[model samples]
Target: MRPISLLLILIGCLWSGGCQQTRLSFTQVETPKVPSFTAPTNAPTLAKKEFTPLAPPEVISLSDELSLHLLPGTPSKLVGIHLLAVSPDAPYENLDILHTALTQLSVKLANQRDLPCIEGLTIHPSIHGLRLSLKCPASALAQAVDILAQSWSSDAYGELELSRLKRQLALDKHIRAFNGSEIEEVWADKILGSAHPYNKALNNRELQQSLDKPQLLALLAQTKAQSQWHLLLEGVPQVDDSLREQLTASLSQLGAQQRQEERFVDTFSPYGKQLFVIDAPGTVQTQVRIGYHLPMGLADQEDSAFACEALSRWLGRSFSGRLYFDLREQRGLTYGIYGRCFNNPMARILKYYGATQQQHTGAFIRGILDHLKLAAEAPPSEAELAALKTSQFSQIALRQDDPGHRIEDYSQAIARQAGSDAMAARLKRWQTLTPEELQALAQAHFGQEPVIVIRGDLARIRPDLEEKLPEWQLKVTSVD
Candidate 1:
């Protein structure tokens, strides 16, 4: 049997339903054991060094954008790459170009480093340009940093790189002044209100017309003056002090102005039923996403996250999950069904999503709601609870398999103001939660009240079930 991660990747590809024919292809991949390579025997043992703590650079707090994460662990032969960019809306517009440039640069840099060991570096750019984060391993960090530093420092394409940097920096100001009226007219038209944060699709012509080198520079200066930039490093305890100093010195060269403090708003919308439809005229299949806002942070309610996860697993995760078995396995009405609950400091949102024949949209929705209602009313059977717990435990164990994951998990928890051990501790807490507690949380949060967002061929789905859905008042919104 394939490892769970590989299995999940395969399932995800199938679930998207982009492929016309389902073909099973099997390949045997070896799973390497931990502690693969040993440290050099002749390497000098350096004394553990500590530096005077410098205050974190004046930068926007991770919480203000999403959660700022920090993960620290024993030093290993891995190098991490993190990109922090500022853009008016989505960073992708610039990053797509940056990625192409970086790919070429990576190859050129690898040859220079004389290290055949370089491979598999991950780069992740965010929806909005708040930050583009990445991670390799500690062993690779020095070489990767050298390549990046040289690239940024080079004058060959310095003018062009600076131009790109300027445009990316403009995003901060645009987001700060994102008044509903202007945003709706410009960017919000392409996104459901609920998925606004994840919507990086920018009005390209409008953005390009509005942006220029002078404007970009002015915004970068403004961001720097406001002291709204900083970088973080975790893992590889040996390099923490040296890396921090090097990063601070490197960034200071940018000559960003220091600011006092930056303020952020905590906003929330009450729970209720809402619908957003995006009509794709010639599309054969519909893509639907259902999400809800949940309380933010781990400590919000006592063990609320664990309870929420348990509920999600029982109703959202497995074929055994309520929606999957009812809508896909038995009814055969949809290709896939699942749920997600993202916990953040500001709010947590739960989502149930699937794709089905446009004709079966109504039946799919009803079946999901019915399963949700049943799960809410009654606690899962002992067998169900055990299965969920086992699954959760297994997933937690799998996360530790990758050094990068460990760092990310730790970093995220710290950024969220949750302690470093929070993830592992939460797993332990979940084990002790009773089925009654899970049911009560479900009753309180699920089925009883939820603000729903549906984006699909509503014309086909709505006519059949508009009257069947409960008496709650409904508001309809169109996607242009």
Candidate 2:
């Protein structure tokens, strides 16, 4: 409710007795009503997009070094250009240079374009391959493709800004210290893991020893032109005749395709029960990592990947999981802990990592190992299996509503020469897993004794650790 105010004024009469006779002047002001807002429903599930996968494009044979897979779709104005390059990890000269070049190229492409900027242009160079992914506006797709072709064809482009790359060639000491500080990363990368060609400390030695411009250039050319590469284009915009001709000419220069298989498995064997104690001075809290390598990985038996992940969740992630209860709820040793099966192209590794004080380290290790040995022999409880399935279903439901999810799956499938739907179908299999099957999976993969790594102030806890596990063989190393 609003109060109405009125005023009487005399225009041509004196203010004495004319007040009542004066004309009354007033205005009615209407108050505006506020709009009521109805909140959107917090629905449990999103309506999943109908399954519409890209029809397979004719595989273009470029050469022994290159192959192309094209996927056409109705969505307009956006395109993805993916590049996968495979090479032996030898010729460590340009390892850092590859990282430098891609970062430089990503920046160059993003800025020097009128087309929707190249977004998420990432380059991950590894021992096996370099995975490159970029999304651009459909309007500039052809231009982006031309630029990629030029990156190979031009002798000057990758090396255009040599001075800039030199600055980033060395490892940031701060980053190195930080990673070393995270004791988990150091153990996997430094102590237990295979020697990386691009190891930062090693980079300083290799970069200086092999700093030949001509040699580096030759290596880059050989990498881009001769070595095998896979190309996957998803959500490619419809091309007019002019654009089609441009693309054909641009990609054809790479010369026919040859398919290759990854038969090389990492010859890795843990040096049994060796406890590597890295000395991080002034550190009161210790980071402990324990696990062992599996002989075979997901690639060897793709069907078991889901089961591996589900088991990982049951042991580590869920509130009711073993690691959570043992490390956090019961012992109050650490805030969080993780145990998971890791898959590289060459191997699968079961790893557990967590943080704890010097006093609790002994208890944490014993508790984790007991669980590991127990899980290997026995079946998980019905409650645990239910928790694992609940997580799996939640992930499946989310993926269903995600068209991008399917697109990514299709692209990866094409790269591995696999059926796109194979990954999704495994969820159904996860539901039907019997206790025997789960136990077998655990025993088969994790039956071996693990390599334990501890990084902390060794001076503080060495006596306690030795006293706790007297029979254990412990090898101590400095974090140099």
Candidate 3:
């Protein structure tokens, strides 16, 4: 009851002449005890289970120059045929043109055949070279393969209109000029030189003069003649014998060619110049990329591979990385940030990039550099290391269940020339990885000063950068 109400009742009792009999009472109760939690005196440590690696894909040589790698998938109605062609001679631009041509031809063939092939007939440029994928219903697998083979042999795009293509190029360039990440282009230019074939810029004038029906045909002919091809079939049990024979005949049409040895290009710049800026006059935020060219790929350094993976995860693995915690959570400098190992056929780049407000760009860069320094100084904690290893194992298990992801992973392995069992070997190595080993690797690799690329309004960011990182040399350039 409220105090006011109690007083009113007391006054009423006093007025009624019954105040002497009115008395207050009190009661006390004992408090209950919380149950004690006794720590186990002999808690058992988690026993490491021995990992059983997935069986490597079956490889069968279709011809002296061509091979088919098969990985059985769940008994499903769909199947995937991935054709990989690798050649240093094939420029990405030409490959892109061929991809467009082949895509159009595939659609035409599908329409003509009246095959309900609506899902997955695609081609794209990969780090290895050109990748063409045909995922169609298993019932139509042979027909789909025949369609693709026929399309490759056909001269469907021989009458392609050059003027129309040039107009499309102009529109594409216009769209990319405003929509694309300018920082990426600048980064490529800096890392792989402006004149490098990989860094070749596509301009309307150059494309107009060079790109046409004849050029496309010549490139296609060259690819068919010189490029080494690897075909992978992943789906269902037992690809029919007739289908195999058809594929073999189609591949045999192209003359036997030796696998071209990957030419090593000296891609990395010497570590001296540290900072570069590309000016974007009207931009409100800055794009920052900082990284170094690794000496070699993980596949080449088997002993240090797991350690490198651990280091990468420690530096940046989405939200779990230290870079995210320090730069975004602690300082509120940027909305997102990441560090990763970019594996190319010729170059292995360890890059960190993100975007931030113009004013915070300098601090953001500082935070990244500081984290790299910290990585060199100390290893990840036991908890962090444990989490990273768990994620690795979990990814392996999960990817194996999905046939699409499995095929992609297998193809990537083939592209890197990292054998079919690379992940299994990595698994074996990861079980024995230690914090001290990771620290050593980090000190060796992460201690170096990395090249930095910043793209934003230079006039706005320059002053803040000057104040924060004045010791670093700043090279400014106009956005291309």
Q: What are the lDDT scores of the predictions, listed in order? A: 0.50, 0.60, 0.67
Candidate 3 RMSD to the correct structure: 15.3
RMSD of each: 15.0, 19.4, 15.3
lDDT of 3 by residue, 61-142 (tens): 8787777887775555567777776654334444545655666655665565667763467775664566677777777766
lDDT of 1: 0.50
Question: Which candidate, 1 or 3, has the higher lDDT?
Answer: 3
RMSD of candidate 1 to the true fold? Answer: 15.0
The residue ranges of model 3 lying beyond 4 angstroms of the native Cα positions read 1-53, 74-76, 88-93, 159-164, 195-197, 201-205, 208-210, 239-241, 258-262, 271-273, 297-299, 303-308, 478-480
Q: Candidate 1 lDDT, tens digit per residue, 232-286?
A: 4444344456655555454544344353353323345554554445444434444
The residue-level lDDT of candidate 1 at 63 comes to 30
Among all windows of 10 consecutive residues in model 3, the one with the lowest summed lDDT is 26-35
Regions of model 2 farther than 4 Å from truth: 1-77, 86-95, 110-116, 124-127, 154-159, 181-204, 208-212, 225-227, 237-245, 254-265, 297-300, 303-308, 318-320, 396-421, 478-480
What TM value does model 2 have? 0.73
Candidate 3 global CA lDDT score: 0.67
Worst 10 residues of 2 by lDDT: 26-35
| Strongest candidate by lDDT | 3
Best of the two (2, 3) by lDDT: 3
| Native-to-model Cα distance after best TM-score fit, residue 410 in candidate 2, in Å | 5.8
Tens-place lDDT digits, model 2, residues 349-447:
567778887777666676677677777778876665755666656665565446456445544444344554565466557768776777787787676
Q: Candidate 3 — which pairs collide?
A: none
Output the worst ten-in-a-row residue range by lDDT, candidate 1: 27-36
